[model samples]
Target: MEIEVRDLAGLGEWSAASALYRSVFGYVEPEFGVSPRLLAALHENSGSVIGAFDRGELVGFCYGFTAVEDGVIYHYSQAAAVAARAQGAGVGRRLKFAQAEAARRTGARTMRWTFDPYALRNAHFNFAVLGATAIRFLPDYYDDGSSDRVLVSWDLSGHVPAPSRSDEVVAPSDGRWSAPDPPDRVTLRAALIERFRAGGRLVEVTRRGEQAVYKFREADR
Candidate 1:
């Protein structure tokens, strides 16, 4: 498919972006859906909205707004979605790359977002492919009852060190499995959560058998 990805700069693209979001996330409730008006308002303010079109039909979109944490400004990617039929087609990655570039131009040094820590594919992509690191474990982070997530920060500043080696730090043992089925859902292991809260920074992840090993460094605090 000839995919064209560009800024969704006007209200004209909002409905299609919201429709794609609903289709991908399977949101049936109106309150849970993305509002074109809200999206348009975000673009009007200090935010961004990008859409991917396939033959003039919206296939995917990513949206986010500027945020400040610890006095550091960053872009908080609020939502990203691709139609079920268009997933695995490199659409999500492309959108993120574009987002990072756009964010840097706006003087942001990082982009923060969250995703299911139990989602192995997301882990691999966010950590291995995008070079982001998990900073916190947000249990029940949302109201929809599907809230378990790992808050991550992508280093748009391009100065963060490479992920430390897996063997350099203590690995959590709470949620180890004997190589379970691929792509199966699991919860955030309690031991890992403790490690994070105790000033640990996840620097590397490796898969052993059905077990996923995570490495962390003691926080400087």
Candidate 2:
């Protein structure tokens, strides 16, 4: 599979990217969907709207914008999605690296994003594959008490270090990537929140026997 990663421009491309985002995430609510107009505006600004193509067909896309926190400028990746057929083909990673390169060119040294804590696959990709570190855990990040997220920061300069020994661990039930049972999910969520509040930063996800364990280390003060 020959995947081409590049910047997306114009309404036609934006529209296609927008539709692909919605389709990949199975988003039906209008409020959850991104508009082509917004994409155009972001592209015009110092924001990144990157897409992965297979023979000119859009297969994956990611978008982010430059943001400042405490006077430190960084890129905040808003969302990224890959077509089901293109997943596991290295398309998502390509889109992210390309996005990081674009942000680096814009004078940003780091990129931040949020992901579901229960998605072990995503955790492995962010921490193990991309070498990102999770600094904060936001319970019900969307204010709906349902969308819990963990905020991660990736060094655009590729200077992230290997994870050290974990001070705490959150092991998934039955070795599953996600907790589908409501009670189990709630328990794991609480565990992660407690660990984060105790000043632990998630550094890696590793397998211990049959379980997938999320490893966290105390953040340097």
Candidate 3:
């Protein structure tokens, strides 16, 4: 399926995007739907939103914005949706890759986003396949009372100076990730959680061939 992707406002595909979200998310009343005006505001800001079309049909989309933090500017993805039919064809993955590219073009050092925790599929995509990490787990962060999703922030611009996990897991680990044993010498998950609450944490999961990796450093207790 030939697809075209570009930065566009919510206006151009407002109707179709909404419909796609409703379809994929399976909402009877279309709750938490995005409006064209809201998307336009996001578009006018530092971040550029994108849409994907296949055969002249709106199949997927995403939207978010950039912010200044610790003297560095980065984009944070808010929401992304794809039609059910297009799920297996790599449309969502492509859209995410495109979003990361857009962030790099803007000179941002990172791109962050939140994902539902209970979504097993998302775990494979965000954590394993895409190599994202979870520095913190915010319990009921959304407080929406109806969803079990957690916030998963990612870094798009690997251009930033940071530690490298060059030899932990040996490649081809596409979503076939395994959670390593908790740190043997420490209980630092709380501190990590705190860092996330303060927005000072950005988790990076590296894949080495078929093996996935999660690496971190805490005060050696």
Q: Give the per-residue lDDT digits (tens) of candidate 3, residues 179-216.
A: 22334102333443454455443344445554444344
Query: Which portions of model 2 show Cα errors greater than 4 Å?
Result: 161-165, 174-178
lDDT of 3 at 113: 76
What's the number of clashes in each of the models?
1, 0, 13
lDDT of 1 by residue, 1-221 (tens): 77888889666789888888887888898988988998888787778788888898888899999899778889999889988878899988989988887788778999999987655677777888898888898877986676677888899877667444333322223243312433233433566677788877775666754467667765534
Candidate achieving the largest TM-score: 2
TM-score of each: 0.85, 0.93, 0.68
User: What 10-residue stretch in candidate 2 is worst by lDDT?
Assistant: 170-179
Backbone-clash count (model 1): 1
Q: Rate the local accuracy (lDDT) of all candidates.
A: 0.77, 0.87, 0.62
For model 3, where is the 10-residue window of minimal lDDT?
165-174
Better candidate number, 1 or 3, judged by TM-score: 1
For residues 104-177, could you state the per-residue lDDT of candidate 2 as single tens digits? 98899999999987777888899989999999999889999788899999988867465455675655545446
The predicted structure with the larger TM-score, 1 or 2, is: 2
Model 2 TM: 0.93
